[model samples]
Target chain A: MNLLEIDTKKYIPKILEAVIETWGEEYRYILVEKANKIKNINYIDERGILHYHRFLENCIQKYLSLKFLEEIGVDTSQDDKNLGLPLDSNTKEQMNQYFGNRCIFSPDFWKDAKGIFAFDKEVIEDFRKTSVEEGQIEFLNPLRGNSEITISNYEQFKQTKEYSKLLKQIHHYLDIYKKLDHEMKKYNKKIQKYSDYVDSEDKRKERILDLKRCELYQEIESELPESLRKYLDLKYQTLEQKLRFLFPELDEKSYIEFFSKKDEDNLETETCNVYALRLCYLRRVGIHNNLNIYDNSKEKYEECLKQPGTQEFIPSFELVDKITRTREKKYEEGIKEFIFTSQTFLENFGQMDNLEETKEYVYNLILNRTKVANIPLADEKNNYPAIFFPIRPSYNGILDLAYIHEFIHALLYFSLYDNRWGSGFDICDDDPALLNPYRLNKRKYERLNETITDIYAVKVKNILHKKGIYLFEPKELVNEDNSAWNNTSLIVRKMLNPFLEKFHHEVILSLVTANYSILLDKVGSENFEELNDCINKVDYLIDCGLNLENPEHKPELIIEYKKEMSRLEKIYHNMDNRIQVVTEAHK
Target chain B: MDIRRIIFIKKSPFRMEYLFLLQLNGNENMIRFTGLESRTDKESINSKVVNDTIVTNFLEHFFRIVSNWNDTYINKNTLDATTWNIVIEYKNGKQKEYQGVDSYPINFDSLERLIDKTIKEIGGD
Candidate 1:
């Protein structure tokens, strides 16, 4: 037999019988009596058909309510009135106790009944053909939009024209409600004031009539068209139900407040794109909080809404300002601390000497037997590959540091050529190939290279100081350039501190020689990729900070940078923890 | 004749300096000069004993190259190129040395390949 072709109307009585049996024999008599009353109604005329359908719907609702109460251990046999009444606090508490965290009222319970009892399109069309009123078929089927909107369907639904039209219609109805509410308040105020002053009954009655005749009173008393009114009511009811489900803690008063304010503040100004994105954000918040939307209070929902990314439906100028100020302060303090520490290292272990001697000393220390010409160009700007120093008559600590920095770059460049241990290692400007060898994109490579060079310069200074060859006092290097250099290097150093602690020189050598597989082998591929991501983020943040004066410094860049930094910190923390665990195991 | 020690050094202005020293002191004692030190001020040089098979294989190839090579090969026109020096010391206090600048004998490529292979086999790469 074809199930779809089966006449569902024939099974209604049998299904009702089964439902009544599940509620126990004590309530079976009452439910049967109600079903008989609904069946006995004359469903011939248009009005009678509507009446019959409503009665049957009410009967089913009562049966479901009683079944729920029975399952929750509520005594529904004593009174029939208890069937459809709202579950009180005591009943709700009992239900919670029985169900624990499990969802007791999900739509899945109705799945089989929905399949068996639902009238197919052909049956509904047949009914319409035979029915005296088309409206009667609507009562049986309701409207299409009454279906629930879930996270899965939300993205597709929001793209439909129906969604946009519905939002606009909702906004229009809300505007009407707002105006009517204002006028009603005025009417009530006039009635109250008149009653306070008027002593005579006839005079008081006359004044009330006069107020009723006024425009405000008439407007307050005016009714919406029945069809429009019904549509709005259905939409509003669905929205309220969804709100309650999403935020279970929301009470009636708070939902009313949220609904009204949402209409006024958001829908009034929101475009379709903004509204869709906001819904996406809300869905994310729902998933993150993991609250049973049916059980939570309004306060919990509000708190979830206030979480960092979803605090506002859209990014506001105020949020951008707050993030900027916080980042600026953090970077300022961070750079200062880094500069101080590097300078302290220099002071404790570094030697003071002239630039000429320091140049020779740093080159010999880093390059050893490989000697390249150490040229101090007359130009003030430095270049790479061929190490160029800005020749100044009186060299300060900053100049000496810059010379060391550039010289390291030159050394690393020369050392990496044809010196890699493995085949298929080639230097290229393309990002994919660069990333293949080192797990670093071009930007990451450049940033890491700069940071490594700066750190090596500081280390070289310390080595020189140990050799009793001091170049300049730490005070001379106390400038912006020094702080900037230290800031970047310090971030990278801190990120790689665990590996550096184990293989300090090897780490530097691997980076310099572009033998990154050595490091990748030590730290697994996952950690290597994470390190690459961290370097990329740091590079992006630095670039954004440098371009703060440029018009391209957008709020999105700052937000992205902030998010990346937090993620990088999390990954680094995980890596550190894993390494510690391994180390401890070895011990 | 039993070889007591072997020393190899290669330097270039545009490349990393390579230095290797091996001493047969009852074991194949291999020492590598890294040309860079740790932050803790540890010596840049590291020494370890490689297996006899690796040393024997390396020397078997090394001796063949030395037999065909001259005492010195120099390309005076190429002033700023690589310079390589190799010295073999025997147990009897006699030494054989070979030096080159920007030039090498016909078997030089094979010798370089053998050295590279031996370095990796000994975990120097």
Candidate 2:
């Protein structure tokens, strides 16, 4: 095939037209309007195409940066640098002093804008050096407030006269929150004390509950101060008022419903999450929280230091969904399936001891990978359960195949972790006998497991294909012609392939939980080879059962095979006992 | 510049594998870690003294990269399945271990390139 080359410059306007069509006429208008407003710009570079690309990048960066800043009352129209995206060393130093290393805008927001949005190279390098010299910057995403808090409102707060009143109000609310927090802790402790007194597990729970129903609890509740009760009532009322004021589109009932669902969804341990969630609510209403107020208010500066992301609101759900849908769509389905399959495999084949926590960890690990670009493909040494393939054209064809394959590897890794004896790594280092098994357990490392993975991948495809859910093109199995099949057949034909038999597969799966090195150490590889030879001879004799030429030889081979089976069973018995001892000792 | 030992083990899902352990304590020594191929039912472990400039230069750059690595991004999810565990034991009994898992320590790709180049130069592959 002959490849045709085209000039990139010729397609620039066409590409722009397509982008404008998809993004809408409004976006194009904004780009042109913003570009015209800028002063002293050189358009011609070495190539006009390069200049056009840079021009587009600059226009998008400036427009998005300015628009986002306007949301926080930065008034980019007055001071463009007020957004704190320093493109030069001079601007960066000024920003450092103003924001103290905290970016005025959230990284997520910039990430959304895209296209050369980060600080210039020199500025970034300077910041890196400073960070290394001092300590890492605690990057905070500046939170915005409701629509009422505009540029004028921020200016009023900065003047110190009007700010004092707002500071007092914030302190009053914080004091009530702290008191309520303490009371909740005290009540929980008292309930725990009462529950511990009863001997019977059932009676302990009943007595505690019954106690709560009695007048003693009422007396304790009544002992609370009237002022504190009034304050608590007022706090909830104020929060509801704030929510209604911010989201004016919603009525009182709708606000209540929103808060109920949102609060239930975010019952987090970290205090910062609450602050960020509240800030998120306020920011959506077009207000700037002006985090500098925390430092300037002089009332709760110390307290504010404890909670991070004071300046930053959590990324909006819409933004998060947009990212996942666009950039992460390639591997998202496969990843979700991979996680589901891994959990299913572990539950069915794993040791099932302390698997609940392990399952949660594995799920979170895979979920976190989906959020970031640096998805770990493989870590056999560290025994990570799953890996993600990079998004490349060469790998696209085999991604589904590899996903299931890696999921099986993860199952194998976790099954070893679930073992009572110890995790695979633990046994490798701690067990004296198992120390050499890493070198000896050559079958897994030798790509035999890969061949098995290939079989399992096909099996998974077949299962999905039956449900009309084809993940990938299923490999055609021509047993006579395939190398994978030939490799699998050799292993199966040589050693009485346990996987072929249901009960034997169960036993083999169980054995995987035990230390492979220890199992091999006890059974002795010599015995395995001998067993392999014996199984082959027995299989040959069975094949000869129908051979009229070897009628007498079949019985003789059967007798010899039975003796070899007895020897194999004895070896397995010894190995199992030793494994049980190790399991018990670890337990 | 006092290097102790370097062990490189390449494992695959297939049967063929290799283990190369190089020691540079006073007298340089190299060990070929082979599997259970010995006649007496034991793994054959042999040690030799071999001087190779490529290995020495590779070690220098490996340590340099490790020392300058920004490990702030090291997290539970940022792990690679295939990893190289480099443990460099010094003369002062201080051991510095670096693991390259999915280009972790951020400079693993460069280190891999260096090692690959050295292997090719020395005809070790």
Candidate 3:
């Protein structure tokens, strides 16, 4: 009986029909249709016979495997094993390996294999209960498709849609796990590389210090919450302390000296005098809110006095005559215009009782006519002599006083306009040293000049009042603290009272013309020098008193200032007494 | 080349002298020294740790104005004024020197004020 010549197609149908009776109609298609296709024997050759034999053998093996799995209560239609199988351990192990190696049915047939195999219902229920207790069977699974599955109900759980969906989910999770593992491996490799690079203790310490110095770490720390950031800060500070202990040369205090020594080595050729010039420039131009101008003024005076040829006196008579003539012309024109064009003056032309009505008119005329010019000195072209009116013209009285005071300054500069003698020094606009007592040269006289200006201003006011042009009241310029005129008025009046009373115009002329030699000749050189020294001492006393009044000074400094002030006051008192005696002798 | 230190000196004919020194320690800190140019007497010299940013700003401005200045400046008009000198030392052991008397650059006042502001920040008068 040759198997190939046995008419396999006719016998295969019979075998498939018998198999369907045993394993239900679900296996009908695989056994009948698939077996018929495999038995397509063209000629009865050796190769054809071999092929037919192999096909029959494979069909027999699949049938036996499925029948054995069903008898043992294993899921033949799905990949899952039926734990309800009442079999020995050796047989279970053999069946597990057999099922794992091959599928008994095609994948399309396996989809409908559930409920086709027959099993003991009670054993399946028992297995289902055990699976539930062991958390193996999912009764209310949240996955898609079948919400619940039990061993007693289905013979193949894996052939269900829910199992396929679960398989896909597992694959998705595994892919994600693989990606995470790869990233972890990469990070570990980077860490190892860095560790290998900074292997030595010294190199590690240097790397740590460099990271601490970097701004990137600070930026990252700033983003963290306050508590965590503070904790990290403490940790870093402790680490830095340890690092500093390891490196003794990085001590903060000694670092300054080290750096300074290095700088000194680099600057060995530099001298101190060059730095002094730079310092002087910085002092001159720097905007210091708390500048001690008194100390600076004293320094400037000392510097000026030390220079041999700083105090040369040379007066130009021609320049003086030119200034006087111009002043006379402007004064005449201003007075004429005031009398002729002023409405107040027109209404009360010569009425002495109505002088108050013409005060504003006279003030306007003086303010309008006062020519404030920037006259450059002969030598220093960049230096311009500017007369500053430090007072506000809020009232007619103040306006008149400021006008006359500035007029006197203008007259002084007018003489300097064409004179070569007034060329050495710069007439700085806001110079505190230009205030009083210190006379650097003929062009810079603060004490005598201010005294003369104040006296002349008052005299002009009185003269204008007598002439029925009341520009300001007599007592308007009498401020005890602020008025430079009032401060110097007493000493100047006492010292020059006799001479002023005798030759008031000549004294005024000589002072304004920068002709101090004329006054020296008149007063005698020794007495002139003494008087000048006395004036300087009075200014020194005033300045010392001002310094003593300042509350910002330290108590010890205040004590010293008081002592100096008292000494100056005594000296000034003696000088005043001597000057009075000299005036009396002159009188 | 990286600048390591800068020293500015000024001497007046009236016997007054001053020194302004700025030094960089590594890359983090700057040391400033200002006083009467008495290197031996440390008490006369005021030394303080200043911010590196301040020194950097000063150096930036210094370089800008440095181009306008010559290696030597002499004022023929006045012989009694102050004399100024500056030395810029680099990390490569090279240096640049400049000196002036009375005469100065066009924006020298700006440089003076910048140095004054920088030193003042570190408590220099």
Candidate 4:
């Protein structure tokens, strides 16, 4: 098949038209209305500021303006610099006087219309030289109304369901917008390749038309509602404004160029993830919480961080964004609850031997990637017993299927043997040592423990489907081998005779957990009767098994048990083969 | 009442820099930060003052220390000055040892004074 040789520019407008159409007319109207609202707000606010010049004219503000003016000694009329950001002269002067001999350059500062200032390039260079901190400008007072005090109307407005729902919708659209932006960047390079080409006049016309139609940014904008559009712009501006003032000489072009110089332009590569993206782009990754590890075991994770985006691809991200707790006077004591609950969980349930060590560990809390991402994935690292949760972090359903079945195996491991031992056998292993011997120790109530877990996992799938989360359930199995046939074949399979006899005896001693159809009301009769008989009949066999513990080296209970377990192994092997024959015939 | 800034320095082994921060208490509640990776090849500077000039003296002195140390560590190869950057964290009133660099604008003394002034101006918190 021949690939189309058409330039990428040609497909731009058509895709954009389809995009705008999907968003519907409401989106376009929202933008237009928002533009008008912004125009009106700026005009009204400007008039209000002019009218409110009385406040800044007062002695205190006037004193600041005067002192600041005197310190800088730069008149407003002077425009020697083509592009110098407004600076805060007083702060610069104080810093300069303090660190004079060690100064990198003369501190220059300017404030914009909102009274936010940027230091001179020289001042910033000095700042960088002295310290590597993202220089902050904490206002002694609030710019808007007191951020601490709640506004009555605004407080009430937030309580409305519509407001809450809109916030959720805004987040959803933001997700879509991020995906679109990431995908469109790939096409930009392809379109630029034809810049020096000797294209015909018709081709040039087509290319220009394509460029107009393909405006990716506009389509993303149209998807947002009026209020949300304004909100996003406000947030974008807040970050941009803060960075510009903080860095002083960071013009948008220079900022973009700085990122462009990087191999992956990782500094400028914005991701849909707000916390990760903002921290990464603005050179404040540490502020998002340290995700670095110092352990030898986690060395693989360290190498991945150096590459552009290894963390995002790796399924289990070891993130550290757990909530913090505070002794506060607010509604939900903030991170305070998070801190307390995590600490409490660590103290009460954690597998810690020393109190001091546990406390220290609890203090340095980190969030699991799956939890932080709010992916349906539950963490099983601590090996904590848990009920079935429907989904996991990624959409990949394989682990969910595998683990869901394994968890039931976990229940058996816990019940049959003590849990003080490390984990059970890896169920995926092909070794016959584990599989051959599993049948002899089975309780008559439910001999096929592994199969039982599978059956329950299927039941869980059905239960979840009722809640709208669909999971594939395997069909019910019907073993064709009858008890009489097993009795007759037991003599023929002489090599597995001892193992088979042991299994049959155990089964006879064990009471059944389930009846032929269903045993909903006979729980006591079915489960207890079977278990009691097994204990009653396997008295000497259990003694021999338990004695294996102390024979040579109190060779751990599991190691000792393995020797005796091989007897049952032969019996289980015969059963597997016979059952396999029956199941194969049905298939 | 005082406000102090902390910067965590991972010396020697990993040599990766991280800043574990916290506010320090005044009057002798010192958080002993032991177990820093390395203790070799370090130069220490110490100073004290009574008057307000202490701020200027502290900054100037630390700047000199860093300048001297930067030359010693990065440029000079005769001696191993791998521990180039020095943290000037304020703990209690007393600076640690010759190892502690006097850099930050407000040490315990100045920070306490600043706090007192602020309290008095705020009408006694």
Query: What are the Cα lDDT values of the candidates?
Result: 0.41, 0.35, 0.40, 0.27
Candidate 1 residue-wise lDDT at A523: 59
Q: How accurate locally is residue B27 in candidate 3, as Cα lDDT from 0 to 100? A: 54
Top lDDT model: 1
The TM-score that candidate 2 achieves is 0.25
Model 1 per-residue lDDT tens digits across residues A420-461: 111111232333544423222232354555555555566664
Kindly report which residue stretches of model 1 are placed more than 4 angstroms away from their true locations once superposed.
A1-386, A390-397, A413-432, A435-444, A462-468, A472-481, A484-499, A502-506, A509-514, A546-558, A574-587, B1-125
Which of the predicted structures, 3 or 4, would earn the higher TM-score when compared with the native?
Answer: 3
Off by over 4 Å in 4: A1-410, A415-452, A459-587, B1-125
True-vs-predicted CA distance for residue A29, candidate 2, Å:
52
How well does candidate 4 score on lDDT at residue B32? 24
TM-score of 4: 0.17
Candidate order (lDDT): 1, 3, 2, 4
lDDT tens digits, residue span A169-201, model 4: 434533442343343334333333222231332
Error of 2 at A33 (Å): 51
Where is model 2 more than 4 Å wrong at Cα? A1-387, A391-404, A407-496, A502-587, B10-56, B67-83, B89-104, B123-125
For candidate 4, give the docking quality class from DockQ. Answer: incorrect
| lDDT score for residue B36 of model 1 | 16
- TM-scores vs. true structure, each candidate: 0.24, 0.25, 0.25, 0.17
Number of backbone collisions per candidate, in order?
13, 20, 11, 20
Better of 1 and 2 by lDDT: 1
RMSD of each predicted structure? 41.9, 31.0, 47.1, 34.0
Candidate with top TM-score is 3
TM-score of 3: 0.25
